[model samples]
Target: MLSKLLIGVGAAALCATATISLADTSDKRIALSNNYAGNSWRQAMLASWEKVTGAAVADGTVAEAPAFTTAENQVTEQAAQIQNMILEGYDAIVINAASPDALNGAVKQACDAGIVVVSFDGIVTEPCAYRIAVDFHAMGKVEVEYLATRLDGGDLLEIRGLAGVFVDDEISAGIHEGVAENPQFKIVGSVHGDWAQDVAQKAVAGILPSLPEISAVVTQGGDGYGAAQAFAAAGRPTPLIVMGNRYDEMLWWKEQKDANGYETMSVSIAPGVGTLAFWVAQMILDGKEVPQDLTVPFLTITQDTLEDSLAATQPGGVANVEYSLEDAMAVVSGG
Candidate 1:
């Protein structure tokens, strides 16, 4: 059941139509508040949120806003934004927490003020509200296991995301657990990519010479692109295996493979995550009871599964049975 719910939420993130009308203004106000807006994927998510949920807003509408991506990637301003929403008496609040524990106090305050609160992507500790998130642990383990089967015995390098972020921690934990079980694979070093492509690329460029024998590389987010660029620049064999998070990066990998005849994998799970986050907020706003933790099932796309473009166009970016939004509302309302 938890899996099903996560799937439902994931589907919402991947496919959303942006024709919602905001003609209605009532007491049932909702806020779509986000932590960071700097990345391409995050921008895409904001667009989807406005598009898919806009249609039903004639009687009530959600106010969309964002917090800047600070030098520390902090959400202090975002927390204050929620406090303002509470003072304004918004009916519900939907958030993507920048830090796991830091948002707990603010979330508790919003909940105390009678606002329905929920989180997405990164969730807070003790879970003051429900969450919609991808299974980072599962994602890390699955990707690493794939790399292990392909590389046999070799040196590996990892480019990770924002330091101390829960998603980063979850993926790292999963990778460590998977790697610990395998003796042939040794992780030589890891540099914080901060989920940025350029940061990852720079990190890899500096580390490549020092670890020339590296055979496999796995990255948490945008840094995957950097790893590929480093391999290209160094004129080295593409890591026997590599995996990354966004679909566009997969497209780049496909291009690299086609042009150079080098194989790579893209295990993208971002689009569906937006869907999951949005629905989780909706469910909570409607007063539905959701599981404390849920993992959206994903696929590790290689050359073979790369041609399913049309199917990939569907909601969640992974094919699945379509569920009606009415059902979600029904579940939330306990009708």
Candidate 2:
């Protein structure tokens, strides 16, 4: 019988060093269901899945691992896809959900069918489904705090993630929390980047002529480099821009540092965590006991650690590190 574990929203920080061994098992059919594929981060995430799952298939740990991407960013569409996966008799489904609450019913159906359902990045709220993610609230707060120190409580431009998504709301709330503590840091303007570089560049460029001088920019991932490009194109002095964990953005930060001693940090969810979720589902299919909710820490890349992150990542990808079975287990166990 399958177990249901409802982890509290305020669970303790995950231990980043706990380890778990992968169980030897026969081939199991796995399906990856993703909501959006419009950004580099999502692209890198899918790439990681392909690479890791390909290796798993070679080792006989997986029978089949096919991925599906939603054309539109619609919850209804994603729900239909999940329903199809359930009808198709998938052994397990790993989802990057479109909405937290929208997919609960479909996820429950998958769980009831004895199909392991695991959601990450953009998560679902179904109690039966396991969720693997970082503390988005903490991620938001930390980025703003870093900006606050550099700006000394000055005006900031907030480049937000997708509107009305779980991660977006949590990160926005965290940014407000940081601003509450630092009254000197005022938000001069806010806009949605939808977590895409081109989208962010267009949005920021359109608004540049109208807004007053800004001291800093706080952005969700996939758009920091775009925002920087916007500032440069507008002939405005680029303020301190806090970066996300995209490869191009980190590369830009490194170049600036080398040329002018520029310093900033990149804080965001790692795209490679998709691989961790894949391993977790395999563990569950292997009948290994795992947590209902596993929290992975944000990939925090500083100037000192940026080069290593860059080295681990590929060109046109996000700066990410893959987690082995042991590393993923440690994140869930918080050991």
Best by lDDT: 2
What would the TM-scores of all predictions be?
0.69, 0.77
Kindly list the per-residue Cα lDDT of model 2 for residues 1-335, writing each as its tens digit.
23222211111112122324333445578899999999777888898899988888887888999899999989999999999999887889999998989899999989887789999888888999998867888888998788766766678899999998777898888888988888988888898999888999999999888888998888888889999999999999988888987879989998999999998899887788999999888877766668888887888999899889888877877777777778876775672
Error of 2 at 245 (Å): 2.6
Clash counts for all predictions: 9, 3
Q: Which stretches of candidate 2 lie over 4 Å from their true place?
A: 1-24, 35-39, 69-89, 148-153, 162-166, 191-214, 233-237, 311-315
C-alpha root-mean-square deviation, candidate 1: 9.2
Best by TM-score: 2
What are the clashing pairs of model 2? 15-334, 18-330, 153-184
- Candidate 2 lowest-lDDT run of ten: 6-15
